[model samples]
Target: MGLKSFLSRPLAAYVAHQYQKWALHPEAAQQRVLQELLRLGPATAFGRDHDLAAARTAPDFQQRVPVRDYEALSPYIERIKQGERDVLWPGQPLYLAKTSGTTSGAKYIPITKDSIGNHINGAKDALLHYVHRTGKPQFLDGKLIFLSGSPELEQVAGIHTGRLSGIANHHVPGYLRRNQLPSYQTNVIDDWEQKLDHIVDETLGQPMTLISGIPPWVQMYFDRLTERTGRPVGEVFPQFQLFVYGGVNFEPYRRKLLDSIGRPVDTLELFPASEGFFAFQDEPGNPGLLLLADAGIYYEFIPAERFFEPNPPRLTLAEVELDRNYALVVSSNAGLWGYSVGDTVRFVSLRPHRVLVTGRIKHFLSAFGEHVIGEEVEQTLREALQQFPEAEVVEFTVAPRVSDTATEPSRHEWLVEFARPPHNAAAFAAALDAGLRRRNVYYDDLLRGNILAPLQLTPLPAGAFQRYMKSQGKLGGQNKVPRLSNDRVLADGLLRA
Candidate 1:
């Protein structure tokens, strides 16, 4: 669609107005949102007839309808799997985004036209806000390289089959869509070695102004680029301006990528999922992520402690407190009602509704019942790295595995990769152990009682993480290396020497 057509809709104006109102007077915004929810037939419309009816008749509508997770939507997914179109929505879905599930193998997430529009608008809002903040929209007007998944549509009967990234790419404004690269679409399930070769050849001499993708994939591309050209990526892609990434944490890989590029390029973090586009890094140099509150989706934040609770308090965006971590729950126009996206975040402030992503509620190490998250582990590692400037941890994963001694039960083990041989491996391990202990009291206690073993450093050969990515069929495009493993299965198999 034309830029004017895309921007001139009443929904766009309404979203802008609501955003302003919510930013300024949050209390009034809450009441207005409640009214809007009621007016929209919260339970009746959008395939939520049962929920709407129950909410309307219940004494406390909000309290009665508890928050739900993807598992809770299994029945709906089963219906779709059984070739039922109207199970999720009142009509046939336009597309289904296929994503890897932690346990369910592959999940086909439904998306309606309105939901597609919502995602597009949310992305547009992020771009507009970034332009307003940096006054450099033209910086992004150059060739934008999106490191994405395969664009091929899987042929599945009675199921929407296209990749979500490909669908969104096709639907962007024509003007802003001109300077884009060809996506990786040869084989959806090929090994990373062949894919990496193809991606490197395609991007070598291109005037790439922006690089966007998962950190691990981006690093792989740069590594291959450096090897082929015998120079760092900065010398190769001089026009590169921004590096946008998401789907996983960026902190661990940030230093390496920046060093490889040989300069401080603009980096943008986006919190998007197969379900819908959730949030994006709006302003440069700001740690807080802005929420797309008006993207035709309502947000709910359940306290981190309530993640596994039978019933958790669902706090609306207005009721959510600042500076506290919360598990994100979303109800989008895509027919997902009060669905938990399995992500945890904390609000940095409320005036503009800025937030910081804490971690995934499930991706944590709780062997000693400390509930250590990915962020905590990264932070501790960063602190340790700071003290030993020469030390470089190329790849690492933390897991709670059974201890060697039966009586000890379980302990947190860190599989670490280094650039070179450390002067003192034992000392380095001690430092890391101390860092973790100091960061969290539970780890400290575990260490004293020998519940958690000393930090183990596995001196992987150079290019190990790269090799691991290559083995996983994820060397190129938007795949990220798994950061945390709850058990030794992946760690042993993937990181085996």
Candidate 2:
């Protein structure tokens, strides 16, 4: 038997056993995690500053450490980068996970040994749960291709620095590393387009059972693969069983990615950021992904509608109600305390603490009180794609078009790059406009009053978004199109690109 087959069965069984204990008693799991964080709190500088060493309970901890974001925590991060010890975490960080400067400029999120453990093992445990629940362990016996960034890290102020994906990819166990496709040498190719070509060449002949990447890049790789092989993905790798993805909401790309994959495969969604690996798909019957309450992270939630309150109420796992949108706050082993990661999520289950990533708390287009979110735009786009079954939108962004002249009333401009252009482009745009009308009351009212023009579809060339990302040095790894911007910066920039 192969090494993966020989080792996977016991691993899956153990993960299943552990998952049951965590899922059935989420509140208890969370409580334990909080207690652990509180224990570790005293050793670091942040803990002493907040009197975390003496803080005995969750209430005491909450009273001392308020909710903060990267801006608030920037000083500590800078200190850590300057070779300071026990600034955020217990000591100097092993690395700085460089997140794409989207909402905030490029953020160097600290990654300690403890935080990296959560990043790696959390994903592993989630996959193990999948294997245990599905009664399928054979997929684990084959090569698992992780479409990630360069593993070669640069030393910055004695701290290794690179993409979080790269750091995590560097740490894969020797056994799994053997099963992982694409050479480390090839994986480090900085140019994303060139990297993708090398990946396509390396993995095309492997026994690929599982593949993981952000959606747009996966679609790009799949298109290249299909064109080269003249075969569907299912035919190419008949044993391919799962597609694991994250970085952006999957609804818009679901049909397109599925079409490229050429068959239905069990898909798992992950909510991992540079800060920490937070949540993952656990159970089939359950509604959102199961929150990792027991992972090396303590979480708090603020209702999204009221997140702007001067002192918004922060709810713990036990306090978060089902079906309400909440902005996530986290205090992790990496030394971030009560930091809002900017993403908003809706809980689907309270029992196991499952959640759906709804939208970004900071990302929205409300130029005319339309209050449109990434989720809404993506939903509209998904529904619009239904009218043109043959066409697929690879990547897209939206901007509000406010006009000075009477000829152009304020409206939304969609800069969409199609993987497969629709047969009738006008019909596709109309369907998209109709979708927004149905989904958004403000949009519908604007249309009814003729205060808004029909949604403008500026169809972009294929790989337009990729080229823009490349030019910006953000071609891959958790970077994505900003879906709903209030200004025309992205649209205008894409035009130039």
Q: Write the per-residue lDDT of candidate 2 for residues 379-439, one digit (tens) a residue.
A: 8888878878998888899987765432445578999988888999899989988877766
If scored against the real structure, what TM-score would every candidate get?
A: 0.68, 0.74
- What are the per-residue Cα lDDT tens digits for candidate 1 across 93-155? 677786543333345677876688876776666656655556455445466666665565665
User: Residue 294, candidate 2: how far off, in angstroms?
Assistant: 0.9
Instruction: Please give the CA lDDT of all the candidate structures.
Output: 0.66, 0.80
Model 2: CA > 4 A from native = 1-3, 102-104, 285-287, 364-497
Question: Please, what's the RMSD in Å of model 1?
Answer: 14.2
Candidate 1 TM-score to native: 0.68
True-structure lDDT of candidate 2: 0.80
Which one wins on TM-score? Answer: 2
Q: Please give the distance, in angstroms, between residue 305's alpha carbon in candidate 1 and its true position after superposition.
A: 1.7
Residue 467 CA error for candidate 2 (Å)? 34
